[model samples]
Structures are given as C-alpha cells and as structure tokens.
Target: MRTRFPLILLLNAAGVALFMSWYLPENHGLWSTLDLAIFHFFNQGLSADNLGYAWFLAIINNRAFDGCALLAMGGLMLSFWLKEDPDGRRRIVVIGLVMLLAAVIINQLAQNLIPVTRSSPSVSVPGVHRVRDFIAFSTKDGSRDSFPGDHGMMLLIFASFMLRYFGRRAFLISLVIFVAFAFPRVMIGAHWFTDIAVGSLTAVLIGVPWVLLTPVSDKLIGLFARNLPHFTKMNRAIK
Candidate 1:
C-alpha cells in the first residue's frame, strides 16, 4: 500500500496533465468524429417521456443532483470509517472531505481559466431536438455551459476517492454511475464530450492522490481531529 500510493498518484497526475494539455482540449479529427457519432446515436430513437430519458437528462443536468450524489458517496465513504475507531475515522473523513473540496474548487476555477467554446448537439446540430423538446426543461436562457463539465467534475472527484480505498469493485461501480448520470447532459445538449472528459480527469488526478499520500492526509486528519471533541461535546449537549 505504501509504495503503490505514490505510483498511483504520479500516474493520475500524468494522465490528467496530458489530457488537459493536448488530448481533450485540441480539436482532433477522431474526437470530432466520435463526438458527432455518439451524439447522433444517443439523440436518435430516444425520448424524454419514458425511461425518464429526457427527464433524466433535465434533472441530472442540475447541480443539486450532484450534491445528492456527493451525499450518497459520502455515506458510502463513511462506511469505511465505521469500522475504524473515532480518531482513525475522523482522519479519513477529513482526508476525504479535503480531497473532495479541493478537486471541486479547482474544477470550478479551472472552467474560467481553461474556457472552451462549444455547444450541445441539440443546439449545434441541425434537426436535433432542443433540450425542451425532449422534456419540460431548458437551460438558463439556453446559455452554453460548455467545456470540462461541472457535474462530471464533481462526481469523478468523489468516485475517484472511492476507487483507491475500495479497490476494483468500487471503481467499476463508480464508473457505471458516472456514465449513467454524466452522459445524459451531453446527450441532451448541456455539454460536449471534452467537457466531461477533461473535467473528470482533472478531478480524479487531484482528489485521488491527496488521500493516497501520507503526511498530507495525516495533517488534514489532525486538523479535523482537534475540532471533533468540541463537536462531540456539542452533540452530547444537544442530546
């Protein structure tokens, strides 16, 4: 576990940097081809009425759903702490929250720094249904929130943390959830492929390593530990 942590951290950092630097941001022929094809395929033979297809897209596009997902994942993450003693559990929780918060903050700020102008298939592609046509929903004034999807960015940060601690099983489950939830926004005309691809990778690289490495995680855990007693006393007082 000790040796593996650094390796994973370095790899994640490298992968994210590479994608951010050259892979996703650049308009390559293959990317455009795949994006166009995937957009058409998802848009076709699907409707908002059933399977919550369009409904799912509309709801999932909102940031609230992302909050719900973080809560759900936080519960799952806290489960790992349940087995540990209070100090150990508190440390892990602190580490996890630090990791999640950092990735989320960085992802949000990076959007402004690495701004990319793109549009959803529904808006850019001819004959594609506008978002409202699929469901009783529309974006804020139909503005494009393109590039490095915030939804994808947020979830991947949480999921990536889970991946390291819980192993392959958790990793695969996180991947499934990511696809199920994050893909719809793009399908329904909220983001481009690169938006998710880049945003998620950025979060994963940042969040996963912070927990996996030492002294850093330890320092964060210690910081939170100092306040837990007061928090516990407050809890007891409330009770």
Candidate 2:
C-alpha cells in the first residue's frame, strides 16, 4: 500500500511521456482513419431518422451513468468511513486521496504534453463527401483531442477500488458504468472514438499495475472486514 501510490504515479508519468513522444503526433491521422471505418461499417444500418435517437442515447448514457458512478463511489467511501475504525478509515481516505491526486497530475501533464489545436477549416477524403464535413465539424468545432477523457479515467479508477473491495459484482457494475459514460463523449462530439479507446487503455495502464503493486487495496478490504460488526449494527439501527 505504501509503495503502491508512488508506483501508480510513476507508471502514469511514463504513459504520459510515451503518449506525447509517439501517440499525440499521429492522433489526428489515426482518428480520421477510424472515423472513416466507423462510418462505412455503420452507415448501412444507420438512417438519418434514427441518428438523432442514437446520439441522444449516447449522450444520456455517458453523462447520466458517469454521475451515477460518482454517486456510487461517494456512497461506498462514506460507508467505509462510518463503519471502519479510525485508523482504517484514515488509511483508506489517504490512499484514495493520493490516487486521485496522482490521476489529476497525470491528466494535467498529459494535456500539456499534447498541445491542443484550433479546429481546422476544411478536410477532404476520397470517395466520401460526408467525411470532409465530419472532419470539419469534429475538428473545427473543438471536439477531438488526445489527453485522455478525465470522466472515463476517473470512473475507471473508482470502479477499480470498488472491485477490490466488493468483488465481481462491483467490478461488472463499474465496467457497465464506464462503457456507458464513454459513449457520451463520442456521441456529444466531445471526443473521438479513438480518444475513448486510448483513454480507457491509458487508465488501465496506470490503474491495474498500480493496484497490483500496492497494499492499499488489501488495507482497504481489511478495514472493511474489521469494521463489519459496526456496519451491521449501524444498518440494523437504520432499519
């Protein structure tokens, strides 16, 4: 647990460095290709009449699910504090805070490494009239970037902790929440599909190894176990 926070920080920093050095430069081209692929693959099944509905669902899924995830995490933390011993609660809080701060720093550093560009005026693609318009709208409208989606990353982090403490059910729930939240950034024109893909990958890169290397997760679970009696008492009282 003591070493875990530092390891997460180190891994996130390395990821930022790698993204800046290699990924960011090629993102625009790569994203364009991906966009074309999606359009071609889905265009057959997609009609203008249904496009609005799809977009609406995507936005709702992204924003609403993310809010729910945040609420869930807050509830879990509150429960931990109320049920755990002071020392246990304190340790869990500290670990959570450290991980959050690390994630924020990584996000900021990644953003700085990948410079934001003003939207381009126009773009053209062979055999596709719509591609140019899509590119112009996405880029010129200030929609796409490669710094990673903070909403997605944060939710994933929260889910990781939930999984650590609550097992498979919590893990599966968080996974659903993450996917739901990611859909909005794409639907609402805030991120490219690739942005979500890479953002998720980036979160995993930082989150998984960090959790594995740290004792914080075990500490948190132990705190919950030790305080189960108090929690039961409190729940009974509420009932």
Using lDDT as the measure, which candidate wins? Answer: 1
User: What's the lDDT for all of these models?
Assistant: 0.64, 0.54
Shift of residue 103 alpha carbon in model 2, Å:
2.5
Model 1 Cα lDDT, one tens digit per residue, 31-138: 677777777776674554554665656676666765666666766766778888766676676767676666666676667665465665566777776547655564
Please give the range of 10 consecutive residues that has the lowest summed lDDT in model 2: 133-142
What overall lDDT, based on C-alpha atoms, would model 1 receive against the true structure? 0.64
Instruction: Record all residue pairs in model 2 with backbone atoms less than 3 Å apart, i.e. clashing.
Output: 1-215, 1-216
Q: Report model 1's TM-score to 2 decimal places.
A: 0.74
RMSD of 2: 7.7
